[model samples]
Target: MALHVSLIDFLSVIPRLYPNDPDYFCSLCLLSTSSLCPECQHTHSTHSCPIGGLCDTHRFHIHCLFNLYVMLNMP
Candidate 1:
């Protein structure tokens, strides 16, 4: 049987961080080289959901998370 999931439930599977954590790397960009680079800092500071982390083994920026969510829900 096929399994169906709601957007809220699907999104809940992704991990998120609040107050900003310096140790967590971006899931989209696994490399620590740009975890908190200047660009990321600017995005985080300017964006609503500034901080985000991997749910399991994937790290990503807050914006990336939103994009992922949209992509997954796209038709």
Candidate 2:
């Protein structure tokens, strides 16, 4: 069977179910942030994606810089 539990619904019941376990938590939700859950489709910023935080936009920039550095060094 498959279970679909929204982050919002799951977080709500956690406090009640485990009242004494205040510190208990899921890292996925904490590590991954959305506007408020489902409202914004979980994209934090313009360059961010729903799954990967910062959609590798910076990696390409770094690659370009490296290429430029190599080109400038070559005789």
What Cα-based lDDT does every candidate model obtain? 0.50, 0.34
Number of the top lDDT candidate: 1
TM-score between model 2 and native: 0.26
Query: Which residue pairs in candidate 1 collide?
Result: 26-59, 27-59, 27-60, 28-59
Predicted candidate 1 versus true structure: per-residue lDDT over 1-75, tens digit per residue: 223557677567654442145555444555534435222444434455465555333335666666666766666
Against the true structure, candidate 1 reaches a TM-score of: 0.42
The predictions' CA RMSDs to the true structure, in order, are 6.4, 18.2
> What shift in Å separates residue 56 of candidate 1 from its native position after superposition?
9.8
Cα error of candidate 1 at position 69, Å: 1.0
- Please, what are the lDDT tens digits per residue for candidate 2 over residues 1-75? 224555456435534543333354333233423332222333344343322221211111223323434554555
Please state the error at residue 10 of candidate 2 in Å.
0.6
lDDT score, residue 57, model 2?
18
**How far out, in Å, is residue 59 in model 1?**
3.6
- Model 1 whole-model lDDT (C-alpha atoms): 0.50
lDDT of 2 at 11: 39
